[model samples]
Target chain A: MHIVDGALSNEVVIAGSVLAAGGIALGLRKLDIEKIPAAGMLSATFFVASLIHVPIGPSSVHLILNGLAGLMLGWAAFPALFVGLLLQAVFFGFGGLTVLGVNTLNIALPAVLVFYICRQGVAARSAITSAVWGGIGGTLSIVLTTLLVGASLALSGDEFIPAAKLVFVTHIPVMIIEGLLTGFAVYLARKVKPELFAELTVSAEATS
Target chain B: MGHIVTSGPQVLVNAQVSGGNRLLDKLDPRTRIITACVYAVLIVSFKSLVVLSCGLALSLAAMQVTNTPVKATLRRMLAMDGFILFTLALLPFTMPGTPIFSLFGYGFSIEGLMKAIDIALKANAIILMLMVLVGTLEPVTIGHALHRLRTPQVLVHLLMFTVRYISVLHQEYLRLRAAMKVRSFQLSNSLHTYKSVGYLVGMMLVRSLDRSERILAAMKCRGFTGTIPLLDTMQFTKRDKVFALMVLFFALLLIVMEWMIDTTY
Candidate 1:
């Protein structure tokens, strides 16, 4: 998911940067003054929450929750997740600057897609139904993210195709865990704060 | 891959390393940020092993100059390499070239091996240089430098707010995890585990949302505007100029080495 500096071709990197900038701009447009606190809080929360180590088998995996993030932040997921990746790269040395845009796009695009597909379902009348939808969205985003990461690699070179396939295969278990956790999280949010999925105050309405 | 927190626990907090009054710590944060970016791209573009090794050496020198901790940096770099090794190991098998060896009757190509080594070198050089140069700056200072570099205002604001609140939210997370532990909660691969962790995260998000609302009200009450004005006293002095020139010369030297090696090839 976090492609390091030289792994990606220049074409992929440049295209990713252009598209990610557009997504961030569009997200910023939808974000008004009032929504800053909510967006920023979620950004910081996910940054911290990513440290959670969920045990799987002999090993454990941390949470991506990009689907949950997309469900929570919609288009703003672009900037929020981008900011998270930036911090991780700069502070933690996880991803490097050259690949930041490609990494951001691979992780965040799936998030925006989830927001579009599951926003209404997560706001369903019954908490159970909403959780189910959230679970599906969560799983789907992970799937999409892996696909994008695979695509980025596969498109780079023929030799990378096997590595791309390996990445997706190893993460099937992760996709399930993400789905279950996101579903339950959405259930809790629905039960406790039903307004969690309410539409953000787009700039037009906030000004009016 | 997306779920891996390869850096382990130390990087989540205490991001600021104690640089002992080093030159990197004193140079304008912008200089470091720009140089890191340029050097990263330059290193990535290089195909010569000679240039790559020199680039790595330069980065190591930078690390020494800045006095970055060896153990901490090694741990983080190794974490990244863990995943990378898995990916790059396959290259020798998938790529076709002169057969050097066989594993499971599959030919391992020398060309692919060289490519893998080249990538590993390039990735490590860029990351080491980046961590030593830009990662030393305070997160807030990085945000302000981005603002000064004419990044979009709203994005800068978002970064500032997020950086400001990471510590606060991290503490809240610790408290919730402690409360869960007090209740004898343990993690296992089961539905109950996912459900509880989900609840933990869900509750944290809900509370943080509520907290943000109160925070907004507090700020509004203080006549705070929507945007935080960039208020920093970062000055680019003669020292920064000297450092920036050295960086330029080093970059040019890398390009020259790359070209000189290419002709010999």
Candidate 2:
């Protein structure tokens, strides 16, 4: 989730900031005027999605929906998530300013994976298959992000084993929750907003 | 997380703490936001535990003088204590320095404990500054601050709408949960409930989109531009400059103290 400032090393924060900047640049390059509304809508949806809490053992985890964001906005999910997170950090202090880059990259990379995975599955003519891919993608993304956070902390001379174990164990329930949420979200999208799929297909075709 | 559900009293306390005071209320929203941001940066930049402690104490004193209730602040800090504990628990195990004590096959170091305390203090300071800013400033004023900060007009507008719609969405979520409860929907250890939640979210998204379109149309009808005009311009007075300078001076002083301690100790 959100890493507060001073939790990680300054090196990690700087590196994250650099990588996030690159991701934002890459994401912005593919923007089309028509996609602006989609981006806005997706950003708003991402903002709201974090509010719905799913109870875990001691901590409540909410649906990040980064995978769904990927499915909907494709590359644009980067900026959408970034902006959404920035607002959350600034307005509600959900996260920290220095760690913004790391959090965004952690979430957006998986979003990109979901986008590509969904693209391939849709091309294979199976919405359910795509949903499954989306679900797995969402779950793995969170796991990877947690691992990265752990690794970053460990690399900074923090006890690697305990932090790693804590992060990994804490995330198991949340990952399962994310997978379920992603699967159902994709299914619903396919049902109610079939045009979204069609638009993705059209965009893919246009790109090719 | 389940504890958050039982946090109604805590939330009420926090709300009351934030609701107190009219002095901060009188400042321009942009100025308040700038002050908050500056405070966050200054607090984070310092590595000394003492300075962080002092910063936190100063912030609390400001809150107290502004009539912010102690119970409210304590409740808010308690909610955040979970995260702080997580950070603290990691420090003694990971940080390197002269070992102070050994417990349960682990060595606790002075450096680690100090670092952890510093982190906790900085986090608290930032959170306190943010609470004061948000409590004092209106949402529209925040929007104006972002605009003044030269954030993207489109994104600012989106945020404006998003903030406006958040309450509506919260209400919708409550209604949905109530309806589910009325139908005797038992949420248990099953994937089915998650899918239901997802479906609900998807439906909400669609509704929100439709609502946003209507809002856009209405704005256009009223000759709304992409940018929202600020009701009051953010002007920096001599007093504002003096305040800003004082903050900077204290921040530098803290940084110096941290450096001296790190070197001498």
Candidate 3:
């Protein structure tokens, strides 16, 4: 769902940048000293994790792991994803700098949304429940991202509607793969170090 | 449409190509970054093919000035613009307008071809500008530029650390994958495959968190403060300002031409 540069209308691009700026600000405020290094490591982890490609058909896709990042980091996923996208745009030319805001918004907003929707469930007592929720989070992130990418393109002009639909259609396989991968990942984390998720639960309970 | 197909080794190879072109490398990172952002907007907003072509020509010149090798740059363009190419191929068949030509009894629209070409040109111009601008700056330079621009401190630090440790973690990932492959593990669309890859990523996460702890300790030992002070600062030179102004002037000219075309038509 990386919306390449010049793919979006100026209106969508400008609006995305504004919203992404707000997200970054909120994420920065939430980024405490303790979470800083963890955020950094997670950002790096995301950077590397995304490079692992899995074959689907003639073309291959890679793990976005934004769902896991949001499940783990909450709002901090904004800045973390922003950095990863920025690096990808700058270093690898995966996306363009012009559309970085749209790309970040498309990818990271779903992450934040998943955190709100599934973080609690992902911290559930039973590993099975946590894994299931994590899977849903992963799948939902891709679904939302593709929708946003499609919406961005479609809103650009009616001419792009077919292409936008094509994007969503192609992403169905990615959704399934990412869902299963995230389920297993959440399951493994629960088994190995339950505290990793326990922290979020405790923090949420404290805040509430 | 282009998801990440490149591998860890490719990422490692890309890490070595940090910014340092004679022309672009000399400009302040801030100037280059701002100009690129402005150029992106200008190029994307352009509706006229003629104006977009001018933008493309200027971007190409900038790429040449930055010493970006043409072949590698074109490959990057292909990777990034693959979806646009697909759209260009499909536009004529689906887009409604006067038919320009027909293939296999399918009529292609003149307006559709123009729109497709417009999108392609804009995409090319923006990518070329970015390849010369952002691509010619080191990661640290970008981080520092962000800092100097008074971006959020936490975000800048996050970007800096991510840039620093990505290569390290990538190497770790390669080793782990190598270990898995040695055991004859293959990536197939199966639950078993997903589970195993999940374990691999999970293990990497665990290691990364542990390393982050150690890294924080190491930094604290060195009297690390919350903010990293810039040891090497970039100063905006007169020449840099002149270059930025010249670019902006040309960009304005393109925008004006686009506006004129819109008004005249």
Candidate 4:
């Protein structure tokens, strides 16, 4: 889901940069002293999560887990993912610098959205119900991300419309995989560490 | 798509032209980062094939000047070309334009082909430039450069800590995964597999939080403040200015040449 440099038009790129700047500002404003270490650790976790490849068919796909990150981190997911993407860009050249703003928006905006939509259910007491909400949130985040990716491309030119649609189509399997993975993740968190969700909720309420 | 069991070392490998001309390396990382950004914006914005080609040439020339490995650069470009190739394959069929040719009752347009090539060239130009500028710099140097550039202090710190702990957390994750595997954990299409992987991620988070608490305590014990002072102070000297000016001149030349070509043609 990483949009490489030079893929977007200058106008779209600039627009994305502006929106991303706003998101970063809001994210930073919400990040208090106590949340700083958690932010770093979550960023590191997100970074390392990419190395955890899940086999699908003959190939494997690295976990994005943006949805889960959102559910856990809320607005802070912006900076957490930005750091991960920045390192990935610098270290592996997975994405380029010019497209950094757009890429960050594409990945993290959906995260914040999912956070708003599913954080409550994730914090709910019933483990199975929370897991289902987590699954939906995970799938929805990927779907939304793919749409944003497509919209970014499609908005650039009519020629990219096909490719933009293809981005969504290709990610269907990823959506399913991530959904299931996230569902189980929420289930486990609910079982073993209910306090994790509680901490996130408390921080979210404090910031809001 | 082979199994990447050792991703830690894999991420550690850089696209540098090993032990090359020290000229590019000597330039301040800030200079390199700025130049790379300029190169990307210039190439991405240019519309003409002539200008785009010139940008590509300039990027390639920079790579040669910096002694960046051609094989490694090509490999990275090829890796990203998957999506570019997909678009290239689809454009002619989907783009609305006069037919350049017809194959199996489908129209292939010359305009679409040119657009695809233009996009490809622009992407390659940026990738090569990044390979020359960023891939060569040390991660810490880049982080310091970002800090010097006055990026948000929080972001800079987050990036630094993430870079420092990636390998440690990665090792922890591997050990945990290995532990699970030793217990006959095989990832399959079953709900059981998903639940187990979810547990794995959950456990990792728990451990990461615990570790962060310990780390915070240790830092506080050392009289840590909100902002840790950077150790290496950077100064932009004559050499840095000279390199920056050279980059500026090259960029202006490309822009003028493109404008001239556009006006003349």
Candidate 5:
């Protein structure tokens, strides 16, 4: 679901880069050094997670887990997503350097959003509810990003209907898959590693 | 050792670019990043195949001037050839064109073939340009560039640390895999294998959280402020300006050339 270089308008690329830069700065301001290793490990997980492709129709789709990252990292997901993307661009060429900022924001924003939503839901009820919220949030976030991407392409003079249809059609199944994956990932975390859920619980408690 | 082997060559290329100068290294990482970003934008704006070829040629020349190894760059591009191959296969069937050849009821169009070639070339050009940028620049430098370019500090710092620790987690993954292997747990079935992988990922998440807590404690001890302070400032020399101008000139040249070709034909 990553947008390749030259696929979008120069305006979007330039403007998106600026916006992403600001997001990164904000993410860095309150970052604690202790969080570095966790960020690193999670970033690595994000990277490795993408390597396993789950087949979807003619084209195969991989798990992005932006929601999971958001739920765990919060705003920290920006940098984690950025690093994972950079590595993917360089090592695997999945995305280009030019579109890095835009792509990072697209994926990471959903993650950050999921973190907030899940935190709120978990405070009022059970872990299962939080997990379900995270899954739904993740799916919605990707859809939002896809729409944004499609809108950007359309604004750049691409035939809006085709571009929108292409993005929406391809991503619907991916979104469902993402929702399931995020739900299961959260469920698995709650089961095998309760400590990992501590931060999410604390954030949820604070928010609620 | 294997990691070193994989990363060493790229590091050497980058070291050469930095040239052991603290001052040069300190220049706004954002400036370089923006320059690269602009180059990518200009390249993708062109639809003509000839212009893309010229753009690729120009990028190669820039790499040469910077002392970047053509072989290494090509090797990296070669590694990503699978995607290019996929694009090539799709283009001929999907792109509109007149039939030039047919095989087993499948028609191949000359126009489609040309367009596919153009897409392939354009894609590679973009990829090569990025490889050079990422290869020569440090992750922190790139992060700093983004900061200067007005990217959110949180995202930049997060990315910086993420790049710093990816290998650490990779090592953790290797250890976990080794342990699993030693226990004689067969991971031959894809479904069972994925489950094991997921569990391992869960364990990794727990370990990562613990590590982050420790890191936060250490940073607090060091009296770290919210922002990472730079030890030096990056100053742009006349040479840097000249370099920037040259890139702009080439981009314009490509655009004009495309215009001329379209009008003439």
Candidate 6:
């Protein structure tokens, strides 16, 4: 889901930077300074988590877990996930620098969307119910992220329309993998540490 | 697709880049950050193949000067190319221009092909330059450098905290995986595999959250209010000034050459 530099038109790049800045600010404002430790550790944890490769068939796909991060952190996923992207770009050269904002927007916006759409469901009384909701949220986040990525590319030029379409189509399997993994992760969190979901809700509610 | 088992070292291995270039390392990190930003922006906006080729050559030259392993650096870049190759390949078919070739019923155009190459050159060059400049720094210095560059204080701190704990938490993650491996856990395409991996991640999140509480308590014990004090004191010395000026001169030369070529063409 990372868009490298020199791919986007100037207008798309500028728009992405502006919108991402706004999202980061909103996320930061929601996160109190005292919560920094938790946010940081969670952010690092997600970075580490993304390294885990779940085998789909002969190949493997690394976890994005943006939806899970959103469920855990609400709006704050924007900044935390942005940090993850930044590290990937710098250390791994997985994404480029100038397109940082666009990549951040593409990955994090759907995360915020997931939080809103599945927050209530993830808070369901039964672990199985919450897991189902988590699966839905996870699937939806990947679906929405693919769309945003396509839109950004397509908006840049008519030439990229096919590539944008391909981006979504190729990621379909990934969507299922992430959804299942997120579902089980949510189930475990629900069974062992229900408070994980509670913290996000309380914070989200208080902020709202 | 690197190994997940040794992710702590995987993330930090590039920090060894700092000692590779004495001249580059001597410059203030702020200079490198600013220079990379400006260079990337300039490279992205460039249209002429001549200009982009020069940018690529220049970045390649920087790599040579730094004693950076040419094979390893270019291999990472090749991986990036793999990511964008499909998109670039589509361009020749998608954009309308003079027909260069035909595949099935579709016509590939010269203009679209040129655009693809242009983008590829720009993308690769900027990434290479970024790796040589900003990517060579220790990750922690990047946080401090951004702070010095007036990045939002809270955001900088967030980056700092993330940088500080990525390795530690990665070690914790490895320990959990080791425990799983001890139980003869096999990663495969199955519900068992998915559930086990998910549980591993969940366990990681739960323990890290608990650890965070202890950290917050420890910070409060040490009278930490909101901000962690900046311990790094970076100075922009004469060498940094000289390097910034050299970068500026290089940018101006590229701009002048591009302008001249654009006008003539």
Highest-DockQ candidate: 6
DockQ of 6: 0.69
Q: Which numbered prediction scores highest in TM-score against the true structure?
A: 6
- Put down candidate 2 lDDT per residue, B216-240, tens digits, no spaces: 6776787765555756667777756
For all predictions in the order shown, the interface RMSD in Å is 2.4, 3.5, 2.6, 2.2, 4.8, 1.8
Task: State which candidate has the highest lDDT.
Answer: 6
- Regions of model 3 farther than 4 Å from truth: A204-208, B1-19, B101-107, B259-264
Candidate 4 per-residue lDDT, tens place, B25-138, comes to 767788888888878877887888988998889888888877766766666667667746876788887778999888898799888888888878887788778877887776
Q: Which candidate do you rate higher for lDDT, 2 or 6?
A: 6
Q: Is the docking of candidate 5 incorrect, acceptable, medium or high quality?
A: acceptable
What are the candidates' individual DockQ scores?
Answer: 0.62, 0.39, 0.59, 0.60, 0.29, 0.69
Per-candidate TM-scores read 0.95, 0.85, 0.92, 0.93, 0.75, 0.96
Provide the TM-score of chain A alone for each candidate, in the order shown. 0.95, 0.89, 0.96, 0.97, 0.88, 0.97
Question: In candidate 1, what are the lDDT values of residues A37-67, reduced to their tens digit?
Answer: 8888899888887878899899888889999
Q: Give the proportion of true interface contacts each model preserves, from 0 to 1.
A: 0.67, 0.26, 0.59, 0.53, 0.31, 0.69
Which pairs of residues have clashing backbones in candidate 2?
A: A58-B1, A159-B94
Native A-B contact fraction in model 3: 0.59
lDDT of 6 by residue, A53-136 (tens): 888888888889998988888888889999988887776667888899999899899999999999999988888999999999
Q: Is candidate 1 or candidate 3 better by TM-score?
A: 1
Task: Please provide, for model 5 over B1-265, each residue's C-alpha lDDT reduced to its tens digit, 9 standing for 90 to 100.
Answer: 1222253343321232333333234334555566666877677778788888998887676667666556756766665565446435644544456877776775676765776576566667877766665556665566666666666555566666666665566567678879998988664434454456546665677666667667767777788666676443566767667766876787789889999988988
- TM match of model 2 to true structure: 0.85
Could you tell me the TM-score of chain B in model 3? 0.87
Task: Please give the ranking of all candidate structures by lDDT, highest first, separated by commas.
Answer: 6, 1, 3, 4, 2, 5
Instruction: For candidate 3, write residues B1-265 as lDDT tens digits.
Output: 1233342113333456553467777778899888888888777777888888888899888777678666666677777676557767877776889998898987899988887787788777887787678766777788889888888888889988898788789789889989999999998867788899888888888889889889888888888778778766688999898997898789778878988999999
Off by over 4 Å in 2: A25-38, A56-60, A122-124, A158-161, A200-208, B1-21, B68-73, B216-232, B259-264
Cα lDDT for residue A31, candidate 6: 78
Docking quality level of the chain pair in candidate 6: medium
Cα displacement (angstroms), candidate 6, residue B184, comes to 2.1
lDDT (Cα, 0-100) at A203 in candidate 2: 85
lDDT for each residue of candidate 5 in A5-100, tens digit (9 for 90 to 100): 655667888888887877665555435554555666677677656654555556566567777777777776777777787766764456676778
